[model samples]
Target: MDQFRSFDQLRTNELSVLRHGFFKLWFELTDGQFCYGKLSYGNFWKTIYILEVEKKTWIIKRKGIFKRSFLINDLDGMNLGVVTPEIWSRKIRLSMNNGFEAVYLNKKLISRTFTLTNDQFGDILNIRTELWGFKKPFKISFDLDMLKKIPELPLLALLGVNLVLIKQAKAANAAS
Candidate 1:
């Protein structure tokens, strides 16, 4: 539905609803690859996955394996669920809450500029350390192409830790 707005468009519209979620969409045309990282509204992070369409499969680099397949070939093997093909633009919103969001795309989820209004500039600043152990906390971002190796695929490890930090804040706030 055209009425379904792009995440970027939604940001421009400036709808306020406490917080919202975004679809995970990242593509590096230079490398001919596509990836997805979802963070639900105020929820924790979800593992990102890359599609190996040439092979007709999606794969995730196993943790502790370091760039190795954590699952066997045909990761889903039919049970993994259907792989739906749709075309549309994609935009992601990263809020101060720090969580994984998964939104369905009406289109291909390719390129769309989305904006996120964060209520906490200082909270993000404050949680920087607890989120990223390094002395400097990485900025809250929905970036997809900041890679460490081979065309700088998304900055995953760092992003993951940041999710942890965000979740902690949510948990603490709930307790309070």
Candidate 2:
């Protein structure tokens, strides 16, 4: 896959994260037609998920046995960033080695909508889950201007989706 220099190069501000398989939960990020990225579980326990965007691959895995944080690493095994969730709130913080930081949190306690915001860029992206779909795909809306400022916008967006999936899985397990 060829690398996209930025999200603006994709020529669209909207995308979707769709699940392909039944049991495996393979996911692909698309703009309704073309796939921009894909994600798959690295193990049966779902502790690790492999993320592929353009020509690059990343690994997102649980940080520790007793922690809720996740660590992101590149294909070369270099640590790229970390995703840490606030204990008493739904907000999650993404901190990268380059000093870029952002927050991903729900728009409302009972809503399926989520937003990603940066201190400098405000709200850069929004993700809403369809209420009627079996796949429950995430509809992503991006701020192109912010994309220009943050080169890692796509990676951050996908990571936010991954976090949401992790939370949903935990909730399902707890319910059953």
Predictions in order: lDDT = 0.27, 0.82
- Predicted structure 1: lDDT: 0.27
Residue-wise C-alpha lDDT for candidate 2, range 1-176, written one tens digit per residue: 56323345577888877888877778888876677887789998888889887767889988999988889999888999998999898899888999988889886779888899888888889988887766647888887776678878778878878887888878999999
Instruction: Write candidate 1's Cα lDDT for 64-163 as tens digits.
Output: 4343212212355433322121234332223111232222221233322122222322111111122332332222333332221112112222233333
Of the candidates shown, which would achieve the greatest TM-score relative to the real structure?
2
Runs in model 1 lying further than 4 Å from the true structure = 1-37, 41-162, 165-175
TM-score of 2: 0.91
Candidate 2: the clashing residue pairs are none
How far off is residue 40 in model 2, in Å? Answer: 1.1
Using lDDT, give the best candidate's number: 2
Model 1 residue 29 CA deviation (Å) reads 18
**Weakest ten-residue segment in model 1 by summed lDDT:** 10-19
